[model samples]
Target: MSDIPAPELAIATRNLSKQFDRLLAVDNVDLEVADGEVYGLIGPNGAGKTTLMRMLAAIEDPTTGDIYLQGERLDPDRPNPRLKRYLGYLPDDFPLYDDLTVWDYLDYFARLYDLREPGRSRRLLEILDLVQLIPKRDSLIATLSRGMKQRLSLGRTILHEPVLLLLDEPVSGLDPIARQQFREIIQVVREAGMTVLISSHILSDLAQLCSSIGIMELGCLVESTSIQELYQRLSQQRLQISLLGDNLAKSLDRAIAELRNCPQVESWTVGDRQLTVHFNGNETDSANLLRQLIQAQVNLYQFQIETDDLEDIFLQLGHQQTS
Candidate 1:
């Protein structure tokens, strides 16, 4: 840490590392997380994801390296108390007090964080509203569903309006519907201008929420890229079509034959009256293909471009590493 002005990057780390006895948990790493961007950290079981999170949250010190938040030094040895005003961390297994009501729980945290006066009460109501827990404010924490508790935990994190949020597996153990709801909450927070760093093994979920992703392997950040750029680098565009009308099998046979011969379509598969095509073509070519189908009198029920999924992207990267 130094008095000299640091670079004004949102979150910057220079050669950060962590050593435990003979093992290096986090290798020399340089990272930059831009302001207002949702950055996801991903890796396998022993890839040091938790350790890195702790280091960033100022819970543990890096063996060597420096961290800067908005161009100011983040000293692990002497972390500033005011840093809490700008940062919030949600660990993987956050505990809760089942004995307290939602309002009381928040009020307790507000006081612990040294929040003052009428503002603290106002912020509590605002957060309850944001978490959709206004109705549950009087309800005991033990009476709430897992989803509600998750949102409530999130509300606790945002009580002070931190600029950066560090969430580790925030949606773990959630059902599909719950996961979707959690995603929506995160989207709202992102729109509110908070930069976020999340860690999760679920690539699909990260795909939905993250603007960019970083992959870790053997204690190193192997790759870092934007979602759009990662998709382009990993695979071509895909188009899925569901055909309608009678003679459906015959329609698909004709469609597959013609589509296979088309220069724009790299390959295609047909099943359940649906066609999935790997296409690497421009919009003009796509439009022309649809126009040709209409001219050929093929009944079109649904035609949509399938976005590249993160599972395949992760697999492709795995294969590349082996190669």
Candidate 2:
């Protein structure tokens, strides 16, 4: 009997780097996405997100490092036709034949991918329906709306039924409804066991769809973690208080210093009657801190504990890049 093969990761990068002359576009970035996961490469423009995605898609070569798809190391010497069959790439721009109808256009690529007979027609129709382009199957590519064209581009990418997808800014120009539709399509693809690597500046969209996120900054992957992990790592346990009173800043500062010196108080900061206290021990410590603050004559107008979210994490990482 033959030994069973180990399950392969959908995408993996080891110290991946790309340089254009002296400028490093992507610098020693390590990324991994499990099979059937929607992984997002999120950052602002010129953050090297596109360059990294292009390398993963095999459209461009990396100046340094390695990429593996399904446990197969991508190398120039070992050209694998199977790689193309297992990957789909949707660039930021959607190229289309102006004169060709939607069905004809998809059929053309389907043929190129060597889909034949019943399978070709069946796959094309299925993708058309998935992208909601069934009604416009016969419509000329030029006649379709921007949203429809985007969907058509997606359909073209998936026509070959590739297991991995690289989408660069897939929802950049889309309206709200179109964006929602695109998200739905992505969800369906995930359900079908397709691994996706999506690059987008829209953090909110990524926050909603991606199973994991990598934040890139200045050609480096500053942070890469699961969304829940990110939230937890950046979460704040201290409570914030606001006070409305005369000489609030001085009063607050003195109170905070006293609270900080307390055995139960871990640390505290105060500015303009607003105080933040981190309890060292537990709920008992927090209660002690609050009691101490009140006894110290720190007038508190409002108090609340706040936890950080994905946006907060992104901003914190961005700030680290600039500073």
Candidate 3:
């Protein structure tokens, strides 16, 4: 063996793939997730994200390739109690018992996981609190709102306190408030040392939560990198200048005329009371441009730099096109 030490990974796969009849759902995917990472997967519908997640969750067998979890080979063919204890998977189509109360449903799953009294009760309470469902614990599952039901489903998924969590489209249909709540809960678990692999179409939420992101197209992982690095590599700089007072129209016209001949400005659009310009310059260039505008009597009210977010980067990569 060489002197180089292998990097520790929470999840790793070698040329992983899956096929259904004629369709190759997940094709030759090599993924690595580090310990305590919140990895986000983004893609259009039918891009194989759900299928890949199923294989990672051990609910589906790959057509070819090897999967390793924490350096241990994952052999789904054989029963591995250790792997079971370390993993928690919540699929998109998770089910809940409509007749059972929230607490009762959680208790049922806790027992299924072989959790005994005292400890089981303690774990249930902790989960309820973690998912912000403590207040509705005694209510019937059918009575809970869509958001509340989803939270309860998540509570069941982590009842065993698994170290590795696989969540597929967890916030698919939740309202803004519900999505925010779900994001906070995920952050808490991440802080508690859970390695989360979450796939979602909501790029804004992923931009806020993920340490790194993987973009899928067709059946391939087209790009994977840290969010910061993605921004540095593909994101562009923009400048927004809003005009002041009742002479806003005149100010906008002057700003447009100034931007028209500026070598630092690539392009610009005229908005109601502002100009959004694509700038190809550094901080000093921006400051100098502001000074020029002021000297030209542009009547500027606010000058701001707007950097591209994850959604912009995704669109820039052109991976949002349907497979």
**Candidates' C-alpha lDDT:** 0.85, 0.83, 0.89
Clashing pairs in 1: none
Tell me the tens digit of each residue's lDDT in model 3 across 1-323: 11221457888888889999999999998888889999999988998999999988888999998888877778878979888688999999998899999999999999999999989999999999999998998999999999998889999999998999999999989999999999999999999999999999899999999999999887899888888888888889999998987887777777887887689999988787878899988999999899889988989779999988888888878744533
Please report how far candidate 2 places residue 37 from its true position, in Å: 0.7
Q: Highest lDDT: which candidate?
A: 3
Which sections of candidate 3 miss by over 4 Å? 1-7, 242-263, 269-274, 319-323
Estimate the overall C-alpha local distance difference test score of candidate 2. Answer: 0.83
Error of 3 at 107 (Å): 0.9
Comparing 1 with 2 on TM-score, the higher-scoring candidate is 1
Each prediction's TM-score versus the true structure = 0.84, 0.79, 0.90
Best by TM-score: 3
Ranking by TM-score: 3, 1, 2
User: Which residue pairs overlap in candidate 3's backbone?
Assistant: none
Candidate 1 — worst ten consecutive residues by lDDT sum? 1-10
